[model samples]
Target chain A: MKKIIYLLILCLTTSIFYSCSKDEPDTANSIFDTSAPELNSFDQWLRDNYVIPYNIQVKYKLEDIETDYAYNVIPADLEKSKRMAFLLKYLWIEAYKEVAGDGIHFVRANAPRVMHYLGSAEYDDRGKRLGVAEGGMKITITEVNDLIPSQIIYQEFFNTIHHEFGHILCQTIDIPIDFRTITPADYAPSTWFNRSDEEAAELGFVSPYASSLPEEDFVEVLARYITYTPAEWQAKLTQAGTTGSELITIKLGRVKTYMKNAWKVDLDQLKAVVQRRAYEIQFIDLDNLGF
Target chain B: MKKNSILTIILSLALAISCTPNIDPIFEKSASERMTESVENVKKLLTAQTNGWLVEYYPEKTQKYGGFNLLFKFDGENVVVRSELEPLRTDSSIYALKGDMSTSLNFTTYNISLHRFSDPSLNIGGGIGLAYEGDYEFVIVSALETEFILRGKKTKNTIRMTPFPTTIDWEEFCQQILDSKPEYRPLYLHVNGNDSLWVSNDETSLTMSYKKDNVEVNKKIAYMFTPQGLKLYEDFEYAGKTYSEFILQSNNNLISAGSTFVPRVPPATWLPRAAFAGTYTLIHYTNIGGTGTPYTKTVTLTEYDNKFLLSGLMPSLNLDVVLDYHFGKGILLARQQGLRYIGGNSLNLTSVTNEFGLSPGAFYIGQQVSWDGVSDPIELTWTDYGQYGSPIIGFVLWFTNSAGLSVGQYTTGPVDQRLWTHIKMTKQ
Candidate 1:
């Protein structure tokens, strides 16, 4: 009887342990919600233009995960954002489309995946950050609260967009060594802010901030040339007296050669196209998305 | 017989465990599924409100800044927000309810009235890292039809939104708050019956500070004014009890659950700061033998922001002295403020830059005789009469080479009691 009890108990316990369901996963995909967002007029416009054509996402609504928490920033104004979206497509996206080798395809391959907007500028002890690019994947534009159409070029917005975009291009193809060698001795990464614009011009760099690094210098020279008029370029040369001017001309020649050889981009043609589009934008209604 | 019974018991217990294996989940749906449903339901409830919702919003993670009453009316993807700060202004913006770990309410577009608190550019504390530290995105912790409990995504402060009544007027409600903001009061928190906490409620920082164990406990109790009373950021704990709302009593004093915010001095009248701009009669005595000389001065007082220039005191010097209205003392404390330029809102009014304080401490205090209600001041008595007792000369001023008040340091003038100690200004 003792043996019978022991065997029965052991068998029953074993059955209890082994009893389980052999079920497969109900769904192959993640259980997380991955639903499509409802598109309004502006969203749909962004989709047709930036999203579908260039595979880009213009995030106007401020998202904490998307922005840098290092600086305090607010959302861009809806009305201003609406105006800016149209202008960006016209002045920036379309400007590239008109110039690049494969046009929109070229933009699709190289352009930032996301373009974020902010109402106010992020100011630090040094100064304000107008635009910042992240790993050639995203670009954040600030101070969109005061976006005036005609004054876009005069202010940092257009120049900053071009500057950030130039960084993306340089990242794609490394900046030529000759360009870096022209102002290697003049580069002051830490104390570049202490140097004035006129002083920077006299030291073979386009702007004071351009003397920070070779990468920054490369982008600044490319962006300034693309945005500035021939007269504006000449004025920079004028300020860069004799030796400084000679260094700047050498650097500029290398930048032009790098763009032509590396990317097949004509700097002067891009400038003319941008300036002409900017001039014609005076009559175009920025608010009209043309959806 | 005992062996057989043990065998049966063991077998029965094992069989029971085998038959009843745990597989059923506690909830009917997954947490993500429930969160999605909850977010959808919240969105529906937000848009379904007839009047809208009243949000008691406190800025910053620590709740160290000010609190604001934000009225939110959600309709589809758009939300129109009104605030107590800007009573008349209304701003509309787009919002989206998306579920991540929890459902978040994001104000996607710029609503100036709402985003001003969150704007880092409007730095109240210090650094680019610190603004009001308000949140544009809020996590809906628990959503309901009547009320929604929220926490800021960045600020991480508990924010509550209750359904606003359709009958109540928003503008009027905001106006009532303006009338009831207790500015610069010597407040006390009555703890039980025997003990009380000496508190300082400052309007500038929206902070209440008290001393405990020789260390100052600065509590930034961000509060908003309602028609009923002042609503604190969260439940304020004192004497082992928590109180969120302070109701205004018949005595016009605010009372919380176990404590009362009893002011040492009566609150200033609800009259606007700009209302104290008019002519007045200056009565003063220059010498001991001098009678309270009444000088009829009919000059329209021009105001630059809150400070006003008061002249006619020491008329021989031809002074344009600046006077600050000390509402707590019911007196205008003489401030050594100077004006630099007057070109399109460029006129500066600072007490530190005493380029215009012709003489140091040459100003006088004009205390209101009565300040109990919301009305224009009727009479102002000279309170600095015997402040600085008998000096030979109250002030001797220096001018620049070009014959204007020069930039330099200035100490408040000795309001010499012996000279002009008896001045009474009655409003005309």
Candidate 2:
């Protein structure tokens, strides 16, 4: 009688377990989609060049989730996006490749994971925003649609890329201690915008924004040195006059040495490569990117 | 005993099953499935109307640019949009239904008409950081076969859309609204069988004025035209009637939409001379010649010879002048002025006519002050007030309220050779 009672209790428990554990509905497809997006020719080019090589995602399509909700920004123009992509690859990526010698390794390691392109400048209450780099992972480039393949505009944009990249490089390996001490007394982070570039240069800084802090001063020197021609740089230094020019020269020397010792990269050689690529852009037919 | 125990177990199991109550689902599908279905339903409704839809979009939450009309055609993943923005062109762009907290319609590609409102460089709505503070992503609120309501994701502005009839010519319809802009003049609001409201446009905005307890109550709002009519940013309500839109009718009359109780009547051909009699302060002055900054001065217009004559001491020039004008024709008659440099040296000069070689027969005033209630009635004409008619150009005058001026501050000149000046004055 005891054996029969135990058997009946076991049967009831097993039946309850079976009823409760009926197979959950297959929600894999409903919850998350695994299909890849349909890519146009431009997207395919980005995938082949930037994505496959450096693992960088070029977001030309304006995704609200990826943007600063505070801003009212529009998507990059398809034509402009294509041109800018090619230009960036040639001027920024390719130039860095030549500079580092190990073309793929340098970018694959230090390059930002994401690059966002905006058609218009992200203007704020204070002023117009050019570009921003966050956490060494994402770099947002604004005013992409305004590119006209001109030398001045090209240098303006390339300077921003180099400036942001310089920050990324510093994040990987801290900025040299010597570079910070060069202009330790002149750093005015809050009121930097009020000062003109000439005034900043006179105060031993490369640009007005450089006077904001030691890190900014360091990157400004690196970016301005690479983008400016030898004559343009000399003119800037000459305009700095006397003690201001001497201080800028000392800061720049420290930057050059730091790049060489720390990253094994020659600053002058990188500038030459970047300048050569920039000149090559004028000849490329932007309308037809014969991919 | 074993059989009895088994029977008890069975009875207990049946009792437990009967004790528990079953609950039914309110919705037939899962939440995710319902969300997907709602997205599809919205998309279907949008694409159902083959002729496309017309949208009245208010980009700014503050309603700075008022409302703009957009004609949109959705087919597959593409959308063709048209508006009255610069270049007046149509563009085909990509669009998608993206799911966030709710399903949203996003213009994935750059459309000139849609993107201009978001371009900060354009500064359409005049705020910094965000141009016009508009939104490209709109959450689907509700939709019917013929109409839909969408709320801007960022701006929180409500956009109303209705299907465009195939018979309506979109371009012509938009052009007609643009063509209906009234000539710069005073507008009157006829309400309660009385022309009690004074309306004016200050080039950038529309202002309606009425006396409330002996104090001038002015309500100024920016406005834009739609296919149906002119829409004011703020609704004008009086006597239990609210008006935000007006349908254009014959004879430059605007009938309030949905009601005939309030209508905007055009200004009379001529205004009474008493309308110009007031003490005004020089609030703004500009010299196009890039010289001679305007100093603050008070000018009083007194009714003279059945017309209005401006009498005042020019503070900058130290000259006493009296000028007469025709209120109806907006003409400034030639006037002679007594000139004397005050302070250091006193050189009393004689009065002269054709003082600036201004064509003798009342140089048809380029810009004249009118009581049309279209703008500040104190805005005087752009006249040549040079010394000895030697083209030592004088400033143009704009006036506002003298006692506790509420408008903006005074401005100087980046003067041009043509001597274009703008001045603001206030009535005391």
Candidate 3:
């Protein structure tokens, strides 16, 4: 009877300790300010064109944190940024959207989250970094100062976009496993620059950089095929000769099959749209962001 | 054992009761609140000024590239900037005062006029991997109504922004400062009477060099031009005095804010004025009317400031041959020097030697008819009297331009006298 009474007292002592504290949650506003800023007309245009449909942010106003700290570079020119943005949409974005049929959804799903514009090219000890992409999320395009309304002038930019977009698609859905086996011995991971473009093409590679890795090779082939005209593509095959051309044709067929099966994109139809828009850029008013 | 256990239980109860912990915060606001307030206050101070702010911007960690002037005119989120490096260039961009590591004033947009310093363009500044290494984001160290102290985010160089004076036009002000750069080399920087620095500058690099311990010590100060003078990047401490500003004197010397530091040319005369001032005997040989006449006289040489005045060069007229003892060469009478100005024209000295023509030097002007210095310290090659009609080869009197010299301006003699003039002064 006394032991039972002591146990009851012990329970009472623990119950007394719980009475002072309340279980109420905090009502104070958050320390972080998440309020949407009043956007300028250009920013509003960016929102309507890019963010609304694709959820991408095109930042011409350079934040030092957004750029590579190691590489010394400057912010993109405003006029140049407008020109490049309009050109990118006209050539790269619209091309994929029109032909892929479902690629409009594919791009909306896999497009870069952020695109940074730089006025000067980011140069290192070896040479210039034309464009840099990180983890299929962000893409920083340099040489905005060199931007012009011409097919030849903005070729590197278009190639870089297609190349990086190809990477994004491949990252989301892996490239064919057999694509690696086709040119297993031709890969030069470190000394790719030693081979000339013609030499690399003879080894069933599109460009010298494509010989760096199997993954790079797949993207380079996809990028070049989309950017190059039929005449240009044939000219490359001519340089490759019969044995080289046979190997390249087999590789390109696999790549085309992979794009059709994995991402549902047609390479030939995409090129036609891209070329049509690439030609249309000569007439577009670059400085106008009114649309 | 029961008694010890009872005492321990009592002690535990007492300890628990005594430990009433205070959970209340000491300050009224949270850390975030304080940070937000600080950022707001800084923004207010930045845009408070009516005119603008003058920035003393130093690029690179070591400040090897020196400093430049960047003027900022802020209106809300917009900021317009101008640079001394490219005087005419003005670029407008957006800025933000953020609650980052500190309240950092970030130049968010591309300011070609200003951000070129930080750009690796391969054209401006250093090329490729090398750049001016300037900073666009400035961490606010302190903020006040009149001044805001900032530290570069990357370079960590201290940058000061003060209210831009509304007195002068920006272009003319910068032009005046650039024009005030040391026109000659080996300028003297006087710290005081005893301690001094022999200063030389490469204006292209904007670097000033001095010799210390027989080794060259270079200092590059980022400067801003005010109406009166230039302000240094920071207070320069040399020989127990701190100099932050320099005022341009009327004599083209820059005097430090403390009045102790002055960078100027110490008088070019090698010897003192007293050393060159004394009476002398004048010897002259005049060949006029085809007859040579030896004329000797007792002349007086007296000190006129740092120059010397001789009374017997042309004895017939009341003329004092003012000789400037300068250029580290004894008594350098440049061809620009004139004498006896009558109306607008003056009778100037035309001394010539074949080996060394009238290139400005401290060669002796003598009365000798020969090349030997033993006869007279000064000598000239006298041409034939026949050549006087064409070029006038010998020393002859002609009314030259009083203002200065031009190539063929000294064509005809206004005064028609073909007088051969020479002077010899023997210091006694």
Candidate 4:
């Protein structure tokens, strides 16, 4: 009996060892591309400014996995990518750092993890696309190659970045319930593109896209306020007329309070910093950013 | 005892399988190592050719915008690309061989000619909200010394690359085709020395109209200039006639591929008078001299007495006026006395100032005929009135037959000292 038991134990042990051996086929690991991304000056800059500090990955190289498979898109131009990187750091990151009074905490905690730059837009079936934020983790900005560093174009792009960042912030901590109540009856949900910004403003919204949803409205107000100049804000308000202007003013007051109470962010201070950076963008020597 | 024997057999079989060494790789290297090797080999092959490679790229799967020729010069990390699409410009950008599911040749950096096909802002391939649905990343299917065949990762369109000999200037070759003033004549494709197929080119596309079972069938194919000759996007066949390749000969005739006797006969000006006599609408008109902007306006052309009565407001001048022109066999003359005010019914000859004249107000200017084609195709060379001296102006006018009147279909280039205007007209 002892001899039989010993044989049984030996056989079980051998079979287990054979199954778990290192020689077992591992096709998955074998095929994986273990190589790192090629390091260049632009990549190094991205690593230092985005990856190291904020743990954000700036993917300027075209990766099919990171893009929309339905629409054809190519990688951003290297020169354009470099220029855009400098602009983003100067305008978005530093401006937030200036407002939150922490060099890394505000962005590191709240910013999207991945920033994807595409040379062309991700045009949908409707023949319109600007930028898209996915699950508050990735933000894709397209048509970066054509950025001319002008205030109008920069404001449009800045609005997108801030809009996406707002979603990240909302994901971390929900927007104040009172903020959604301000424009409760006015959300378009769809068909907002058919309405002009002036028309949207008249309906107690800051921009046309803001009228799409409560969340988009909250973000649009914040983004537009931060990026728009004093003149532009006044023009929007004036265009909204008396009743609409009053409603917008009430909504802005609620947003200001919500930022201060919830995230401890000063909306007015953030706007000032962003506006100053926006004005100084054209003078920044994008090519020779001494990183 | 029985259980112990079964366990022993299983153990012995497991041990036997485990003791077998990894089967000797068919290739000395492992599969991963072989993949890496292949990637390197492809990279080396790309950069090895000193004269670079000509890439015949079809951007769309449906093959809508035809094919384009691009010359690629590859270095270690960068590729310099040139194309006739962007005339006389070469752009250097980054390229990489990446291992995804398969080894891919990716133009990771934006080269205008390479990326324009994927740019969403420009709709070239008739794909809504998409550029041409072109692929920037291509899977290297087969690589050889003379040719490399690649399939687009996204579009799945086949792209072929072959070594471009240093002796040939690709730009000059393309420019020659663009500059060649082939008589705007109908070409006759003779098959087996019996059946004939009519061929016509609209400068951008080739159209073959033939009778099939007593019904007129027209097959339009998009084509581009190749180093050798003209390459059609799709093969054409009708009534025992089949050809997709043509070599331009010195005599301005296209000889079909693999044939010593087959030639596409150029139009011999069979019908000229009835060509320009039609009611036409301006589809595209550009004023290169002034603002250099194209205008799409509803302008009517009434042809009578060998004269074209243009009774509509010229967008360039913003005037609602009547202009008359006399077109002959190979000469189109603009009568100075033909300028008139539609409301006043009086001649306003002095309104033809230098700016106005240069603005297509030279409506009174005559054009010297260069090439005349069947169906009243007329290419006219005129002089710009505003330019200091009499600068020779060249323009091409194409007309198509309609019910009772011939319509002016296409026009291009009153190339005034290098500045050219393109005007397209369709029968209304």
Candidate 5:
């Protein structure tokens, strides 16, 4: 009877322990919110690739779609999200081409979900941030209620990607300290708006929009590199009352040097790739929108 | 008991492993890194290229305009240039070049010409019976040594030169010539010369001369395949006074003739090529400036290809000026019309006898192009200015070709009675 009692107790305890162990929530499914069917694709991709394959632990509730992807605030509207994703992909391609030679690493959704509009350094609520090893990155474009029309959705998405991804590169490997030094002391929040065009010109910048901050300036320069041909920049300088000849030479020289010395990347080959990517996904059909 | 203990241990290990959460390190991009990224982004957004022109004019109607021609044989190069007048014509062809010269090379030849219609018969029923006998060659070469003229009572020396070089050291040259007269402001060689060498005596008499060997080739002038007439003076001192003689001939003729001669008096404005800064308001009646009160007029400036357009006003005579620029040749083609200046139709101001009050003219360095040999009526647009100090109160003109297009704008000058017009050009 004593042995039977002891055996029974042991069995009970073991069964209980096993049951408890089984209850350890499947982290892969923990982040999924069935109610938000719109993120099904995103969630699935993250699960199979991001979460399971890469074993990345991400803190994001699929149910709270409003605050997610601040850069894209269409409330997980499938069409809008798709569009934003497309534009982001375009910008990513564009930005990637200058730093990385060719081809981008596309991650599965579960690998590590990117949360939009969360970081303090982010420009908007949807500003972007990245996870290097496991989870990917988060980029925010706008507030939940501030969803833009499809007409400008692509541009806005591109801008957010451009801005947020800027942070990724900065964080991945430190940019040269000298780059910050040339940015000037007045470089701060909202400088792009505060300074006049002429003021910007005095500092070797193209427009005040490029004068926002050191970070923003970097992105703006990159955006221009992706969008404008050297000849085009030269033409713009002509409108500014000077040939962009010298400035162009200086700019190209600095860009090449920065990419190689600081980022250990080849810029020329990147330019070619970025140009190809941009050609694939630029905001061109806006003219048709009016029709 | 051992089996139970082992099972418990296995269960505990499983629970511990399953519950453990792995967090990924947040990656942050540095500013320099961001710059690299941004640069990467910029490389992605792209578009195309645009172009235009800028021109400056001198006091004596001499003009020099430098700009990039978007669609030309000389694409992507700054074509700085100047044009002058030949003795026997209205304006000479444009002397275009590739680069800017720091020092004046030497103004020996105004080898620029254009074919224009000077038909007096088209208006007054018939007079000089002037017809553009095909293309005529016109050049603004140096004033012949014998081409000196006695303008006033004083022995003021004056010579004829085409559109002169912009920079000239008159004082230094004057000191070398005459120790008596203190050199005033260095007069610009606004017409034809690599460097204008001018010397004057008592009055306003001026003599401009250049050597035959010091001529720099004008690229713009060469582009046009037209006959250009050239006349130069060969002046030598027979006695105490200077006597100069000149020969009127085409550029082809000069090359063909190759002879020299002496003269008795200085040559004034005798030109197969006109002086770049000649003082001549030849045809004048109730001058536009004569109207004491200012009036208003509207003008339309059109391009040759009918693509470029600009408009302005004229305040005094209430006339309109239609201005156009030949992008290929860098010429300012203008047409003037009075408020009541009309004839058969089409801005009839082109007729002088009808008092049409129109001066249809083309500004060039003296060269011509073969274009169906009849009087090629250059089309122009005009406007009038009624208000005082109105900006751009004149005309704008345009010209287009397979290469590209250009525009010229004219403004009313302060000299009202003088019918002064300032011109501006830009590429399109």
Candidate 6:
């Protein structure tokens, strides 16, 4: 009886050991450590720090994880994955404060989201062929790879959240007709092509990249207005050349006026906040995680 | 001993159980907790990979392209691109060869304009609209009304009234207006070699040395702004095509907004209406020399939003009148009104100086000056020897702002010489 009992105990131990052993691959270990915990400590951190502040939460099934290039990227390791989540959450909080201001943070509890392990795949180049979003369910990121990078993870988060929220704004209201008149007939993609910095400045764009496309142009203005100092933009405009400077100045003026006249938000204050946040992040000891 | 063994077993079992809780193979989180319902959001992502901004797809399942660089800002309502500079690059294949490549970009001029159309032939494209901020060089090619056949759709593009790209001779015209001095004021005319007012090629004649001649002219002169608000010399042109010259002059005015008055005498001097009003006038002659019946007509002026539209035409006789007028902001008029008879059936307002002979056509005088206020003119004295055969001409002048709206007049030396002379008049 004693021998039989010993055999049974050994069998159980062996089985348990085998099961636990499968979880310890060195390759996978390098992928994620802190992010692999049951509740994903990084996500918990986000919930505790970011989601509540912005009044938003994300939920998703593990298998339906979506990734996009702008706000997500392929991760290099578990540590990197954790860093990315932190960055995204941080950016979310920053964008929220910059755009929505105080007392405007709250989201329904049941929004859907697809939690992704930071080191999974490139949001645009790999993994699932869809985008990441929160509808009304809790999400889990089981895998970790390249689908989320730190820079992409942050910038894209800021952009996507803002853009999606912008859609919400539009769905609920309409913009003025005059805003559409500023784009002239000759605005071309080539306008951005091969233009020198001096020339681009004359044209009233922050950079050639801002001049690359109209959507970018608009978003850059929005980002600059909601997050940066108006003086910074104005200075940039003043430094721009003849062809595009006037247009940019006019556009910026219109944006400020629109924010005031339409949304009734104190955009200048928002601009101050943006500048402050940018300064804070720029000076933060991010350990070389520069965007 | 039994109790102690049992306690040890229980403790070990508890540890084992606690340590072996199955950690499901995947770390999963529910999707609903990550959304924010309290605040409006604008997801303005600058494309990281540069495939262009993702617009919506109709099917909701498939990815589609829309040519609009959506600026997801609080434009009081939704996120949208306000300018063509923010145009979304759509699928280029839908339009033409450039369309496909264009769709890959985030912003392009074509995406904002012609790319909106699915058809190639129907892209009339947006022209220089109200927001136009830069200089444009437009060369009038041709005018026609036609229906453009779009891809299974047709569009019509038409241009009704437009001006061909022609340079306005501003300098010479201004100088001539400056040369038309008011009844008693001395005037000086500055003729630049590069002056657009006159077609003269020699720069030497524009210098102070060209002013040595002393001469007189047939009519007194002054300066004013035009009825259409341009600075010009109000004078008549009678020598060139008889009635043809009059028709050409009228056609030119109508084409260029009916704002220019070409001088008849020197032929080089042109004046805007206001300058003509403040500066020069034609001495009306009722058959002073011969038996060609005297022509007369009563002219009436009506105001059209600060502009005077001359009405009533006498069909039979070519009549001339000496006139004076007042002009305020937005007002325009000329100083002199007169006529010269063309030999046959037409009479034109011209500057033909013949003391006893009947002029072929009736000539009219107009002066154009400044409406945006005038700049102090430099006091300059010079003589032109060329005017002696013609007559001694004197000038006085004033500039209206830096855009160089100058008002002045010119005259022949003492009216003793039969020279086609002018003087420059300065703004008072």
Instruction: Calculate the i-RMS of every candidate, to one decimal place.
Output: 10.1, 10.9, 17.8, 10.7, 31.6, 22.5
TM-scores for candidates 1 onward, in order: 0.72, 0.71, 0.69, 0.71, 0.28, 0.27
lDDT (10s digit) by residue, model 2, range B1-428:
77887779775985575433435679877777777777778889888878789887878776656677788889887788888653267888778886677888998767888887777765223433554777788998888887898999877888888998888777876777667754434455545444366665533356777777788888887666765557775678755667788777666566774443223343443444445567887543333333456656677766532234455534444333334444334433333221221211112221212233232212122333444345444454334344343332232222122121122212333322112234445666
Considering TM-score, which of the candidate structures 1 and 3 is the better prediction for this target?
1
Worst 10 residues of 4 chain A by lDDT: A149-158
Can you list each candidate's DockQ? 0.32, 0.34, 0.19, 0.31, 0.01, 0.01
The lDDT, on a scale of 0 to 1, for candidate 4 is: 0.66
Q: Pick the candidate with the highest DockQ.
A: 2
Estimate the lDDT of model 3. 0.66
B159-238: candidate 3 lDDT, tens digit per residue: 98889888865687678767764332324554445445443332222234445677877766555555555666666665
Docking model 2 quality class: acceptable
Worst 10 residues of 1 chain A by lDDT: A20-29
**Residue B34 lDDT (model 6):** 16
Candidate 1 has which clashing residue pairs, if any? B361-B412, B361-B413
Score chain A of each prediction against the true chain A by TM-score and list the results.
Answer: 0.89, 0.92, 0.86, 0.88, 0.54, 0.53
Instruction: Please give, for residues A28-117, the per-residue lDDT of candidate 5 as tens digits.
Output: 443322354333454464455335633433222212222322321111223334343444444454345335532233223211245442
Off by over 4 Å in 1: A1-20, A27-30, A123-127, A289-291, B1-24, B123-129, B182-185, B188-193, B197-199, B204-220, B237-243, B248-252, B255-262, B265-428
Per-residue accuracy of model 3 over A18-43 as CA lDDT, tens digit each: 54465354457556665788687678
Q: Estimate the Cα RMSD of every predicted model relative to the unseen true structure.
A: 11.1, 12.6, 20.4, 12.5, 32.8, 31.9
Ten-residue segment with the worst summed lDDT in candidate 1 chain B? B343-352
Identify the runs in model 5 with alpha carbons over 4 angstroms from their true place: A1-76, A90-136, A143-156, A183-192, A229-232, A239-252, A262-264, A281-291, B1-428
lDDT of 2 by residue, A147-264 (tens): 7776633346668989999999998888888888877888987767556567888998888789999988889899999998888899889989998999999988999998898888
Top model number, lDDT: 1
Chain A TM-score for candidate 2 is 0.92
Tens digits of per-residue lDDT for model 6, A101-219: 33243222212233344322222211122223333232333223323432342343444444344333333444445544665442457535344456556656655545665544554
Instruction: Write the number of the candidate with greater lDDT, choosing between 2 and 4.
Output: 2
**How many angstroms is residue B199 displaced in model 6 relative to the true structure, after the best TM-score fit?**
90
Off by over 4 Å in 4: A1-37, A152-155, B1-28, B123-128, B176-186, B193-222, B233-244, B258-428
Backbone clash pairs for candidate 4 read none
Q: How good is the docking of model 3, by CAPRI class?
A: incorrect
Poorest stretch of ten by lDDT in candidate 6 chain B: B56-65
